[model samples]
Target: MPRQHITTHIAILGCVCLGLLAYLFHLDQPVSVYAGTTSTAQDFDSPGSVSVVVNKQRPLGDPGYVPAVLIETGGISLRQEAAEAFAQMARDAEASGVAITAVSGFRTAESQARLHDAYTGRYGTEVAESISALPGQSEHQTGLAVDIGASGGECSLKACFEGTAPGAWAAANAQRYGFIIRYPAGAEHITGYAYEPWHLRYVGPDAAGKIHGAGITLEEYAGLYEPPSAPPSSAPGKNAVEPVP
Candidate 1:
C-alpha cells in the first residue's frame, strides 16, 4: 500500500473508534444524556409522557385528554407503564409487610368535574378549590397518578395517612418502583396541593430517582414552578381532587 494511503486509512480508523467510544459513553450514562441534551422539555411535559408534569399551572393540553393505553390494576386504571410498575411495587410492599392498595386512578374529565362540583357544593368553591382540583386540572385525569391506602383503609387520603405503615414504606421505597408521593409535605405552594402521602405519580425510574434523591417536587424538577412575583396567571390553588367514594 502507498504510504499516503496507509496514513489516511489510519486516521479514518481513529475517527471511527472515537465515535464508537462517545456512543458507548452515552449509553453508560443514559440519565446524563437524558437530562442534558436528548431529553427535551417535551419529554416530560407532553400528556402521554411518563414524566409529564400535570399541575395547576400546567393542565393537559387537551382538557379531555386521556391516556392512550390504560390497564386495570387493583380495580383501578393507570397508564400501562405506571400500572406495571405499581403492580411490582404493590407485590414488593406486601412482601415487606406493608399492604398498599390502590384507592383511585385514571379519573376522566367528566368524573373530575363531578367530584369537583360535589366538593364545591359541600364546602363552597373557595374551600373546595383548596382541596379538590377543578375540572381539566387534576393529575388523576392523566392516568399517571394513583391514590393509595393501606389494605384496611387506615387513614386513607387524610394527612394522618403519612404516619401509616404503608405510607411510610411507600414514602421510603416508592422511587425504586418509579413512583413519587406527588404532593409532598410543605410543597403545596409549589405543587398547588397539600401533602398527599397516598398520591403516587409514576415518572419512570430515572426521573423518580432524581426527584426522590433531590427531595424536590415534580414542579421543581420539571422547572414548572413559578415564584410569587411571576406566578402563573391561571394557576389553580389546588391541583388534586380527593377520591370520592
Candidate 2:
C-alpha cells in the first residue's frame, strides 16, 4: 500500500475509535436529576397518571350508586375492574359479618368542581387546596378509589377500622383479592391525602401484597417499581412505612 494511503486509513480508524469512546462515555454519564418532575409516557408503573386524564369513558359505568358495603366509594365512578375487586372484598367482609358501604363514587369534572368549591367555601381555598386535589389530579377521577365505612353513617373513618375487626380484617386480607388500602392512617404526607383508611385501590393481588408487605405508598411503590434516573426527593413526611395497601 502507498505510504500516504496507509497514513490516511490510520487517521480514519483513530477518528472512528474516538467517536465510539465518546458515545460510550455519554451512555455512562449520570442519570438526569430532573427525571420524575416532568410527565412522560414511559411511567407505566404510575397507572394513576395514565388513567386520570379527563375523558368521556367512565370506567365504572354511568353515574349511579353501587353497593357501598361491597365497594369503597370515591369521587370517580368505579371502574369495572375496581368494582369487581371491591365486590370480592365486600363478600370477604360480609363473610365475617361486617357490612361495608360506599359513600361516594365517580365524580365528573363538574362534580369535582362543585365539591372542591363547597369545601373551599367552608374551609378557605388554601386549606382546601392542601386537602382536596384538583379535579384532574385526583385519584378518584380514575374510578379506582373506594371509601369504605360501617353500614351506618355512625362510623366514618374516625371509627378506627384499622384496629377494629373489619378494618383489621380487610387490611390483612385485601391483598389476596387485589384490593389495597390506597392510603393508611399515618401516611398522609406520602399519599398527599389525609389518612383515609376507607380508601382502597385495585392493583391486583401480587402488586397489592408486595406493596402491603412493604408498607409504602403507591407513590413510593410506583417510584420504586420504576425508579427515576436520579435520586428521589425527600418524601412527604417520614418515609412511608410501607408501599400502598
- Candidates in order have lDDT scores of 0.85, 0.60
Candidate 1: 10-residue stretch with minimal lDDT? 31-40
For model 1, residues 1-245, the per-residue Cα lDDT tens digits are 99999999999999999999998986665332322323323366688888878777778889999889999999999999999999999999899888899999999999999999998999898867767797678889889999999888889889899899999999999999999989999998888887889899998887788888888888777766655685556544587555579
Alpha carbon deviation, residue 153, candidate 1 (Å): 1.2
| Tens-digit lDDT string for candidate 2 (1-245) | 99999999999999999999998877665532222322122233233432222112222232322223333333235777777777777787898787677766555556766888998999898767655566655556566666667666544655366656666677788888777787676765556567666666766665576667777665555552233368665576575565566
Model 1 vs. true fold: TM: 0.79
The runs of at least 3 residues in candidate 1 whose Cα sits more than 4 Å from the true structure, single-residue gaps closed, are 1-42, 227-245
Which residue runs of candidate 2 sit more than 4 Å off their true CA positions?
1-76, 157-165, 224-245
Best by lDDT: 1
